[model samples]
Structures are given as C-alpha cells and as structure tokens.
Target chain A: MADVEGAVLTARSRVEVDGWQEAIRASCQPLLEAEAIEERYVERCIEMVEDEGPYVVVAPGIALAHARPEDGVKRLCLSVVTLAAPVEFGHSENDPVDLVFAFGSPDSTQHVSLLRNLARALQADLADKLRTANTVEEVESLIQGIVQDVKED
Target chain B: MTTKGNPEKRLKVMTVCGVGMGSSLILRTTAEKALKQLGLEVDLEHVDVSSARSIDADVIIGQAMHTEEFEDAAPVVVTISDFTDVEALKGKLKEALEAQGWLT
Candidate 1:
C-alpha cells in the first residue's frame, strides 16, 4: 500500500471550482504533487469526460476521474476534491457531482486490491459523508475509517 | 454467444471497464444494489476489458468506451452513462429482462 491517506492528504481542500474542468484539475493536484501522475493525466481525465460523456460519475454526487495509465501515471495513487456546490457532469442519472475521486495506477492489475478496498468502502455508501466533509483532516479520518473497515473485511 | 431465452435461468451479469479494478467493481456494486432493490437476482461479476474477451455473460454491462470490445462475448452489451446510478441501472436491467421474458 502506498499510504492511501497520505497520497490523498497531499492536496489541500478546495471548496470551490469553476466547473468540472477545474474540479478534475483540483482532484488530480495531490497526485500531481506526489508525482503519481503528470499534467497529461488530468487532461486525459477531462478528455475522457468530453469524449465519452461523463461515465466517471460512478454514483450520485461522486465521480471517479481517471484515464488510461498511458495518459501519464507514474504510480498508484488516489486523490480527491470536494465541492460545496455540485457541478453537472452531463450524466443523466448521476449528475451534479460534488465528490470526485481521482485514481492513477501503473496498469490494470497493479492497484486492484487497494482499489478493491476503496470500491467496497464506496459501496458501503460513504458518498454522503465524503461529500459533506469540510476539511482534509475530516476526509483523512473518513478514509482512515474506511481503511480500518477494509482491514477488518 | 448463448442467449438463453429461458425465463427460469439465472441471469449472468458482468460489468466491464478499461482496466476493471475501480470502475468495474463500482458498477458491479451499483448493479447489485439495483437488482436487490427491484427484487431481482443474478450471478454478477466484474472484469477488465482485456479479461472480458472470454467471459460468458448473459448481459455484459459497461461504460460506452470499453463495452464494444465485449460485443462478441455476450448476447447483449448494455452501455450506460454512469455506472453508479442505481435507478438508471435498475431501469436498464428491467428493460433487458423484460425483453428476455424474464420480467412481465
């Protein structure tokens, strides 16, 4: 594990953004700071939304911003950005996302287990809590809680 | 390419994604939530696009970009805008099941 919480805490909380473009950039900042990904990675995530029509809106109020590892991923990482006011991702069902989870992995298989745990935690229905988080510490606590839950499972 | 029209057969649902770890698992969780909400049951799995080549599923679901790769692996390939919207997923699965005579 590459310290999911540490990887995430690299980005300070940004409460406001101009739009999804800003949102994706804000979300990937920590990963970029950590050198887990490069600028092109964020651009690729944006390109994916524009080209594929916002399939990243994995759940209501939650979007996982990601692209091919070839886009610019240097390591396995998870980063996040939360908004006080949600922005539309053009998704018919799960539109207007407030929480965006940015993931970068070396390949399809490298971070499967780590991401698998995160996926289960998301499936545990933490979107509302994560979306409402006001600070990075709160987010880390939430993530730490999930990490604990992941360990227990 | 086995499209068993039998209403009694347990539907085998598979979710696919570009790499499959994060997105596909999320989709599977979303699919299970929807199916459970509608009182539907099935055997569901999640796999990456590359691994999806040989998996036999009654209906393979995924985001639009990577689903086309699985067209030959399943009788039906269901594409969706978002993988986590339970309502949309429920609606699509119902439509597919209805078309198969699995639902009235």
Candidate 2:
C-alpha cells in the first residue's frame, strides 16, 4: 500500500448532485485537479457506469467508481463524494448510493495494495461514517483515524 | 484433484470487478468477512469481469452486472448488491453453496 504519512483526503464530504453522473464527476474531480489522474479517467468511470450499470456500487450506500488504468491515470489517488441524498445506481443489489469513492492507479497491482488498505478502513465502517460527515476535514480525520488504528494494531 | 470422490471438498468462489481493483477488492474483503462469520473456510478467486469467461470455480460471487458473463461457464453464480452487509452475504453464500450441493 502507498504511504499515507503525507497523504491527503480530498472529498466533497457534503454535496448534493442531481444524479449519479454528477456524483461520479464530483467524486473524481478532486483527483483530477490534483493531477493524480487525467480527465479521461473521470470520463471513463462515467462511461463504465453507463455501460455496466453501476456495478461499481459495492455496498447499498457506497459506490467505488474506477476504470482500467490505461484509460488515463497519472498517479495513484482516491476521492470520496457523499451526496446530500442517495441516488439510485439502477442496480438491485447495490443501489441508492450516498457515498461515492472514486479511485485511480497507474496499474492493477498498485491499486490492489491501495484497495487492500482501504478494505481495512471500510471493513471498520469508514463508508458508513462518511455518509453523515459534514466536512472534508471530518472525512480526513476518519481516514487518518484508520491509519492510527492500523499503526496501533 | 477434482475432489469428485470426496463429498467433503470445498467449493471455489470467485469475485470480479470491472478493473479487478476497486469494487472487486472491496467485495472480496466483504466476502471474506462473511465467510469468516459463517465459520467456513474456502478458496476464493478474484478477476476482472471482462475476463470472466469460462471460469473454473464451482461458485462465482460478484455483482449482478457480471452475472451474465458466467451464464454457461460456472455451475453456480451468486450476485450481490450490498457487499457490506455480512448477514445478507452469509445467507446468500450459504444458499449458493447448498444449491450447488457444496453445503449440506
């Protein structure tokens, strides 16, 4: 997993979007601005949702949007977006997502390790908490808290 | 060994995501957690949904979007929506296993 020592959490912790597409854009724009990924990566994420029907919605209220690295990735990055209200991803199993997480990597392997670390945080109810957070700092604190717990463990 | 001669053999479970990184990894973790809660240890595989053709697992666990990809390859397919819900996942996994005679 990449080092989180100087990592930053860039999320639209609280925002309202008209629909899932907006949600996806909002979630990934931060990574785009940070130069962690190219605009095409964000577009690819949307295209995937349009083609695959929101399969990225992993949990009832969480959507982890991403695309192939070759689509457009400059660096490894993650962005979180929490909608003011839930938006349907048109899937029966994992729809009505209120928290969207967009991620990017230079390749599959690097993303896997990053996700492995994220899994630890998510398994600890990180997404569930993100639903109610009102600020990006709160989101950062939640993620940092996970890092602290991991270190303690 | 195909384990065909033994009735106690475990089933192979596979999970897939579009990139085999983001959603797949998340669901994989959730699936493992559910398996642990069920107190059943098993072999699981993860793959990119695009490469999901002719998989070798007895059971494949993934989102509903990938169900069609394994229409003829796998013997059992379990599609999930809420990977975070371990209780639901355990119930579904048990059902999939029992349906395929992998669970008694």
Candidate 3:
C-alpha cells in the first residue's frame, strides 16, 4: 500500500469555496504548491467534470478529482479540501459534495494501493470528522489516524 | 465465457472510471470483497472509461454516469452508486450474475 504520509500533500478543513470548481481548485492548490502537478492537471480535472458530468462524485458528499497522469503530474500526491458549505456537482445520488479529494499520480497503476487505503479511510467516519475539523493539523491527523487503522487491517 | 461455478474458469470483471486510477480502483476493491462474500471467483481489473470501451469483459462495473456510456462494453454492465459500499455492490453483482445464469 502507498503510504499516506508520502501521498498526502495537504489537508484543509472547513474551507470556503464558491462552487464545485472552486472546491476542486482549492483541493489542488497544495498539489500545485508542492509541485506535484501542473496547472493543466487542475484544468483537466475541471474539464473532465464539464465533459463527463459529475462521475467523480463517487460517493454521497464526496468528490474525487483527478485526470490522466500525462495531463501534468510531477509526482504522486493527494489533497483533501473540506468545504465550509457544500456545493452541488450535478450528481443525482452523490450530489452536493462537501468533501473534495484531489490526487495526482505519475502513472496509472502506482496509486492503486493509495486509493485502496484512501477508500477504506473514507468508508470509515473520516467524512464526519472532516466536516467538523477546524485546523489543517486536525484534518491531517484524522486522515493519518484512519490510514493507520486501515494499514493495521 | 463459462457461466457455471467452475474453478477453472474465472470471469473477467472490469471496473471503470473517468481516469481509472481513482474511483474505479476503489470500486474494484469493494467489488473484490463483495465477490468474495458472495462466493464468486473472478478476474478484476480497473481501467479508464475510454480504455474500458475497447476492452472485452464478462462484466463491467462502474459508476452510473460512466456505465451509461458502456452499454455495449460487456455482457453485463453494473452501475454502482457508492464505490465503498460492499453490501450494495454484492447485492447488485448477485443480481447481475443471477441474471446471466453465472450464479446458481
């Protein structure tokens, strides 16, 4: 499994965003700051939503934003951005997402384990804690805690 | 592909997403657990939507939005609402397998 400590680039809680696009951008900001992905990566993710609908909204209240690795990924990294107010992504079942997870991988397969761990973490109560977290540290710790728990399993 | 519960024949199950690396992989994980609980053995792979359309599989599972585009990709295309819900996936997969006579 890809280690969460290395894959996680940033974690922010209760962030204010205007809409789904803004929320995605906010989630990608840390990846950009860490030079994990280029600007085109973020644009591609937005364009994917525009072209493909809101399929990235994989679960209720959650959106996973990503594009092809060639779009512009410098390294493998993940970002978590929890919205202060939930925004609609046009998904019928998993609409009005409040938690956005953006990730960039150098290739197609390297991040599968990371996503597996992440999937397990999300299945836990991480979403509820994320919604109420106030600081980035709190969010990071929460994620780390869950990822650690999944690792033990 | 062989439909009966033959240990020699493993069904090809493909899980797809827009990019394939993210949500689809998660769906694959959930599907793996679901298939195990349902006492089914199958080969599973995750692919991007574009690539998935070109590949052949016995069953294709994906989000409702993406699976809508894969109507002709497989014998059975399953739409999953939640990628992390094993019970939901198990129920849906059981239905699809039964419909195909793959489950007895």
Candidate of highest TM-score? 3
Q: Over the stretch A1-153, how does candidate 1's per-residue lDDT look in tens digits? A: 444433333334546887888888888987888888989999989997787667677766788888887889888777766776789888777778888888887786565555666666776666767766778887767766755654565
Candidate 3, pairs of clashing residues: none
| lDDT by residue (tens digit), candidate 3, A36-107 | 999999999999899988889988899999998899998888889888899999999988899999988888
Which structure is stronger by DockQ: 1 or 2?
2
**TM-score for chain A, prediction 3:** 0.91
Clashing pairs in 1: none
| Per-residue C-alpha lDDT of model 2 across residues A64-92, encoded as one tens digit per residue | 88888899987767778778888887877
Question: Residue by residue across B1-104, what tens digits does model 2's lDDT show?
Answer: 12345757776778887766777777777788887776667787788876766568777788766877676678878777776666787899878766665555
Give stretches of model 3 more than 4 Å off: A1-5, A146-153, B5-7
What TM-score goes with each of the models? 0.73, 0.86, 0.91
When 1 and 3 are scored with lDDT, the better candidate is: 3
**Preferred candidate (TM-score higher): 2 or 3:** 3
**Candidate 2: where are CA atoms >4 Å away?**
A2-8, A146-153, B1-10, B69-71
Model 2: fraction of native contacts: 0.76
True-contact fraction per candidate equals: 0.33, 0.76, 0.76
